[model samples]
Target: MSLFVDSSSIRNFLRRDWERAESQLGSVLSDTMVKLGAVLNELANILDGDSAAKYLPLVGDLRKVKRFINAILLMQIEKTNLGRTDFDKRDLINLMLLHLNYPGLFRRIRNLFAVEPA
Candidate 1:
């Protein structure tokens, strides 16, 4: 019947749309992972054989950026329902979210955003 055919066509279109969206999200996630890895590497460099105490401030800044990166990845993973496969259990954002979901956890994470790098 024509009605059945139309319904099938609609389903196919929706499936294609969903696939496209998923593909785009995967690309974004991949990009974010690369950026996060770079930031982590920089942090390692700062921690390695620090000759000056001033480097401590820079280390803190790199850490904050890392947190921001994790937050973004966590949000995307949650939206795409890909957290389990995309991120490990020790993921910073995952831990942060876990704490955030609890009551009165804002005091901890809120200060993180308030901090400004020198």
Candidate 2:
């Protein structure tokens, strides 16, 4: 589904998406920013990893970022510290931040596993 074809294209894609992710200000729900699709896609893409909750694109809400970080980053990476990860959702009061990963990871995964590109 991505447009990446080679090293050059991969760099271009990362630069473009990474810039877009950086320029973004994590303003909570500015109309369509809080939708399920937006949240899920952003998570799936792992955009702006390591950004604080209030700085991620559509995940600035301190009330809805826990599940993703817990399920994706904290769980996927097997962190030893259980409750001290990003997206500080202390006492059922917060949720935010994307997982840590470079933008080029997508292309690398595709290159390693994709088959029969049409």
Candidate 3:
């Protein structure tokens, strides 16, 4: 339900339908990134020497999420070499990304394909 709203907002943005989709994703990724920063900062303060080593994966995951969000935004507006008719998935970090740009019946079909795990 909520994901459909998100995808529609993003599509509106890419199609230059800005007035209504202005807030689009509503800073969801930005908010997540900020929390990641806070976690990293806290880890830095409490971790040191040998104990700090184990927290590396957590930090890495945070960074990956931050990058993933940025990548999605960037790719949303990009056109493939085939022209403005299609979007390329080779560079998209999330499979859900490609689904958003498709139109009409395809878009609905894509929604089903990109469904999140239950």
Candidate 4:
């Protein structure tokens, strides 16, 4: 047997891969949203539910973080909805994944709380 593949065969192979990856990404996004929601809920419970609102800027920051992640998820979810990957879709996904990276987000927020008001 010859070890050569035609262009169409390669295209089909890549297309199937893209579709599978998209399905997996959709599951990942859904699971991430669920876990994030649970964490936020747990924080609220620890803060005493309705009283969590009394925390002012901390509570505000929590809300902002939820919105931020939702936005990122929606962007990253675009390729999954299309069920395919292309140059454009991959660009958005890559950037969103970077945004989801650790410590930068945590450190930035931690610094805000670390300030000692004069």
Candidate 5:
């Protein structure tokens, strides 16, 4: 018997995967916010000295980055849930790439969330 893959089945599989990814991305955003809050609390405890001076500006910059990330994540989640066939996927991919490639921003974020070595 000849075998053929149904087109609708492929579409359904892709849709499910996309939904799963969207959910995971939302979870990641939530986790990132929590981590940022923790970092903010730590920074707040250091009210003076060189560390505070250095971190104060970094935290400001990080806040701006966080806002940008929140917007991107919200846009992606909305687009994915809406299943807008006309939406250009490339735009979402480009935004993700831009965030990843943004000089020092990604590293700073990572450091904020990093677990210190014992």
Candidate 6:
């Protein structure tokens, strides 16, 4: 006799499998820190007054954002050294969503990274 699995059961199984896969991928904190570092570096390259003027209105004050990013990076480093995994996953997710929704900003960041230093 063959046992039939219901749709809900299959969905639950798939969800659990996905969670397991995510867990095996390692800490989300580290991934977010790396992404933030890339963004920060791109920002640093474009932070001169004239270059930052256009972006400031879209992203708020560039200086404040820079400080915030640095703080997050430092906190992540400390947590890692302490063997801690706790972090605000929502903040990282929201930051990613913000980037995704703002194509212009994302393009600017991508362009900055693409340019070769003279």
lDDT of each: 0.43, 0.36, 0.38, 0.43, 0.42, 0.45
Tell me the deviation in Å of residue 54 in model 6. 1.1
Error at 31, model 5, angstroms: 8.4
C-alpha-based local distance difference test score of model 3: 0.38
Please tell me which model should have the higher lDDT, number 1 or number 5.
1
lDDT of 6 by residue, 6-26 (tens): 333323432244335435866
C-alpha TM-score for every candidate: 0.26, 0.20, 0.20, 0.26, 0.23, 0.28
- Name model 3 segments beyond 4 Å from true: 1-60, 75-87, 94-118
Task: Give me the candidate number with maximum TM-score.
Answer: 6
Expressed as tens digits, the lDDT of each residue in 53-101 for candidate 3 is 4433322233333443454445442223323436433223224333432
Q: Residue 103 in model 6: shift from native, Å?
A: 8.3
Candidate 1 CA-lDDT value: 0.43
Clashes, model 6:
0
Residue 32 error for model 2, in Å? 33
Q: Model 2: how large is the Cα RMSD against the reference? A: 16.5
TM-score of the candidate numbered 4? 0.26
What ranges in model 1 sit over 4 Å off?
Answer: 1-28, 61-118
Number of colliding residue pairs in each model = 0, 4, 0, 0, 0, 0
lDDT of 1 by residue, 1-118 (tens): 3322232233343224333544576755565554444433433443444432433332234234334445555655334433446654335433543453443665666676796878
Q: What is the C-alpha RMSD of each candidate to the true structure, in Å?
A: 18.7, 16.5, 18.4, 19.8, 20.1, 16.6
Which model is ahead, 3 or 5, in terms of TM-score?
5
lDDT of candidate 5 at residue 18, scale 0 to 100:
33
Worst 10 residues of 1 by lDDT: 2-11
lDDT of 4 at 97: 32
